[model samples]
Target: MTTPHHNTAELAKLARVLDRQDPADLDFLATLPPAALRRFRDQITDLIAERESRRMQRIGAAAKLIPAPIAAKITEAAFGPVLAAAIAGSVDPARAVAIASALSPSFLADATVTLDPRRATALIAEVPDHMAAATARELIARGDYLTMGRLAGSVPDRVLRAALPHAADIDLLHVGYYLEDTDAADRLLAIVTDRVPGMLRATATENKWSEAITLLDLLGPTERSHLGNVVAHQDPEILDALLTAVTDLDAWDTLLPVAAGMEPSALQRLAERPIMQDPAVLTGIADLALTQNLWLDLLPLAQHLTPTQLHIVAARISAEPDDALTALIEQAHTANHWDTLIPVALALDEPARRRFAALPVMHRPDTLSAAVTTAATHNLWSAALPLVDVLPPHTHDLLATTIATLSTPDFHAALTAAPAAGSTTTLIRIVLRQDPTARAHSLTLLAESDDLESLVTSFATTDPEIWKSLAALNSELPPRLRTLLAAQAASCGHSDIAEALAT
Candidate 1:
């Protein structure tokens, strides 16, 4: 795949092949994609391999006259590692394995660096376990991870298991980072499962963050989560360093799934980073979460965000296309993340809240109903009510009908919550649009509750047809409460309420 991650790994490979320490040095090749660069690297490797094969063929013909032992000495003494590795492919497999067995571990270790297992697969796999271990120890001592990483894929499991202990933690990671094939990387991780924590500590302590993150990108989700959890439990300073590494590398795509799998305490610690607090950074984090379908997994950490951060995030969320916003809300409903989502919605100031409420999804009866029901269940009425105030009248009608379905105590609690939630006028407008029976039920509860003055004071604030709304309003209210509504409306300059009530 041509993922940004793939390009990075490809660049690492290309850099190794060219012996270029800095990617910037290869800027002339920048326009070539990773796959093409890979092909180009292969072409160069092939030309060298083909030349070596011709040389090996010449040596193999000469070796036919001698037994394996004499050939091993002559080859080691004359041609050394580079030619010994090359000629093994042209030599017969049994002859090659026999000659390899007689070779010194030091000779073999140096030869392995020049070896292409593809050229002599049998010769490499047939290397005895003891020989493999000694060669591995030599390579580890030399810090020649590139060779170990290559041979890691070709060597037998017994050889790998034996070799694993000699390498230090960072050395193991260097091999892991250089591993070209994903299955090989997976196999390496599997063999050293018990050592992942130590490897992670070494990555943090030694500033090998790029290699650590590259290994993380190479892993599948399950493995990434496991590794991520191990990394998460490291010191907060270490986690902070990892975050800095991710930012430097632009590896949020790699970090998202890992973050999703972290335990709550670890997530809170991650959230405490100043880098995580920036609005633009949090917005990008959220965008990636939704893009990756990790909102459910990662949003639990949002409870730790600051209010200012939440507001800015909500503003960006409100600016998303309607279809996308609707899908996100539906996902939120499915995931029951209202505790996290509600605060984000409420943090939107009035103008943004109006835009959010006016969305096409907000107009859908089912969407509004879920919002109300979820708010109640999540005890987010304090947040949901302000949003309710700005919704179109059609949504208000559905919301009113939804409220009517509530049992008496729930209804009374909602009535009582409206004023404290700063949505008393919104509640009055919803009541104005309710059915006669629900309107009567609401007024009865309103009269019995301590919120009547709030009700009377806010009733005149509902939009459109002030006199007609007064008619619907006065008819359902009790005689005593009717007097209060009329007086409050007139006192607020809507003399029509008093004139109509006077008749």
Candidate 2:
């Protein structure tokens, strides 16, 4: 028979018992007879200590399962070093896999693994297809041809000679990307030499851009040089993937040369790809090329960008304090593009903003004010406050009004403005009026008020709610304030106030 008891009801009852009985609440027992409260305090302290000990025991038990010192070193070593060391050393593959598996899978798939030659050859014959593919790539990364040839016998040719696979191809690139010997790249390229550009075109039709790059990387630079031409004359979808893959300028330079070598119509077709359509990416490409001092390569694509991109490029080139930042700020302002200029201004701080403010476009107070207010709005206080003087005439009042509208206006204003005696008093009164339940929180602010004596003396009647507010702010108030407030209320013959205000 199934159990019929209500598990949820039992748990709810247990939780209610716990919530109603906090250990700190036992502090009230201090008012009880001395012996009784002392015993109660001891029991509560013992219970809390025991529960804390159990939590620490569970934490220590879990910590033992991990090799802490070794685990800490994993992130510092790049994937290539870690994986190659795992394969080359006499360590167990299972242990190595455990460590390597924890690394980023994308980097792992792309990193080289160099196995001990004899072990590499033996594993290829003995291991299954999946294991053999991993070991063979690692063997190639070692740049040992005899080992690679012997290992290749059992492996699939498509995996070795044909297009490299995705996440699966990471290991292949890992080998090829780091190889020092020229012959290694030569031998690697030789495998893909027989296939013409037609192979990539065929692959692209199948929406196989991922595999095509793997194959292209394996080819020597000369063989892959016509890629821009092939891509230019090809379908647009193929061109998109090719462009997205060019993350840096060196890759762009290689591809751009191939693109320039192609027919003009082919280049136009390549330009039609979605990757080339976005202004940000186009500008990023131009900026990247300029960074590499490839100004000539960047010239052909200059007109393709929007004004915003050109401003970004200007900001990047004017990297030093001299002229680039001024040019960027000017370009961004003319384009009505504050988003682009704000980053450049903040990047330099007071000196940069000072320099930018000196420029003709920044001369208008409103523009500089808007920039500062924008920085403040985003809580970039350091940036905003430094530009405070550059703000327009009316912005300070607007900033004040905006700050006062905050839910916790006193706290927010305290953060924005430097503390002043009179200002702090006014802010505290404003916050106290807004808080509907003005007990502990507002009472703490009131205690901090510079006019503390005046605040207390004005409340002559000693209302119980006010007494409760003071008491809740700190329990010590009951004994100290009770005597003085009770004397005042009794002398005034305010019976209701005398009773509530008494300790």
Candidate 3:
């Protein structure tokens, strides 16, 4: 979780557990659950600790007896950082501090990496604040957030306060990730709380969302939501960059949760971003959400989209295989996200909409009822009615029952509030089927559409598949409108509609 593996958060955590070792091991590690991976990490760390202790037992006697100055000289000349680390833990605590203080901060910092604090607890505790502070600076210079993070618990608070300001916001951001110890991570970040905004701006500027998401995950929810809001206000280019990184890394697990905590307007901005609407990005997001079961996180985002973006989402979803679409419906039903789900299904061209409505899975009464509930809650008659036109009889009956439950005033108000004009004919059919008493009222409301002529004309002039749709509703149209729709249907060679209207 501390590193940017440009993969799912699970694999990234696996990388963290493995300390970025053996790229090939990931294939094997991927098969294990998180708890198993944690156990494996603990065993590996323990094995290293035991082996390190056995490797250095004799060095303690030599260090205490040989004198500090001589040892420092030998350290610089013979023992490198790794061996020095192993020896430091075994020596008498005072002697260890003396030997460490005599070395340059650069060398101490290098050795500090492997100086298992669990073993060198005394030496780490006894080390002077100045020496620790100096070494922190050296580690930061080396871009070694890993060592700083691992030993943060052992570092004096005063030393950390002094040393952290020298680090870049990005460095602070990354250090937060490397701290596996929750207390240590919180202590380290608490010092730089004021720097969070700067940290985010730098992340956006650097397009480091991969690393940023890793850190955000570790910060837990409250902090993540705060940062998520800040990120929402970033410049358009930042979102563009985010889209690039998220898709490339497939880090949706982390990013989508952060996105969920954003303000409604912020979520709306993000949903409408041009790059976010890219068909490839949209399809990839849906497919990834489906594959990873991230629908719980992704569905809230759909609630923020405007109709324009709904069209984009609908177009992207229309191409999914029936099985894929069915899976999406299943997920939405599980999440109770059908309010948002219906808009995209309805926004599809009539052909795709018909195909989607015919999916056998749509017949589940529970699924249709949940969708109707969401649609009613959101007053999505503009969207829900169009898709209802293609639904099976049972679903139609369900929708009619829902309509029957609404008062005539509420029903007419819902019709009056149609958010778009595309669903006009479908709305008229439903009005006649379920509440013929509101016929004059709904027709009067729809009669004012400035685009009505062209809208109906296109039914015949455009795709033949769409022209045939009017035939189903023609008989429900009033005398003049029914005649006009029949003529339009016959002009498009759909005489079945003309004959039905004629009858």
Index of the highest-lDDT prediction = 1
Model 2 agreement with the true structure over 1-503: per-residue lDDT tens digits: 00111121122222222443333443343344433433443455346445555553453344345564453244335325433433322333344444445544334333322232333343323333454355444444544333343223333444464323321333333334322233454554445443434454555445544434433443445545555456565555556656766532225644554443455566556555666666676556656555554444443333233445445554555444546545545544554445334543443444545555455545454555555445545444433343443434344444444433434444343433422212332333333334344433444444454544444444454344544443333443334445454555566556565566664
Name the top TM-score candidate. 1
lDDT tens readout by residue for model 3, 122-202: 777777777877888899988877677767766667767877877889888767756655467557666787887788778
Lowest lDDT 10-residue stretch of candidate 2: 1-10
Ranking by TM-score, best first? 1, 3, 2
Candidate-wise lDDT, in order: 0.75, 0.43, 0.69
Least accurate stretch of 10 residues (summed lDDT) in model 1?
1-10
Clashes of each: 0, 7, 0
Where in model 1 is the C-alpha error above 4 Å? 1-27, 30-32, 46-71, 86-98, 117-128, 153-159, 248-253, 278-303, 315-341, 365-379, 400-419, 424-503
- Clash pairs, model 2 backbone: 109-170, 109-171, 110-170, 111-174, 112-174, 113-138, 318-324
Off by over 4 Å in 3: 1-45, 52-84, 87-108, 118-132, 152-163, 174-191, 203-225, 245-254, 306-308, 404-412, 418-503
Deviation in angstroms for 64 in model 3? 9.6
* Per-model TM values vs. the true structure: 0.72, 0.27, 0.65
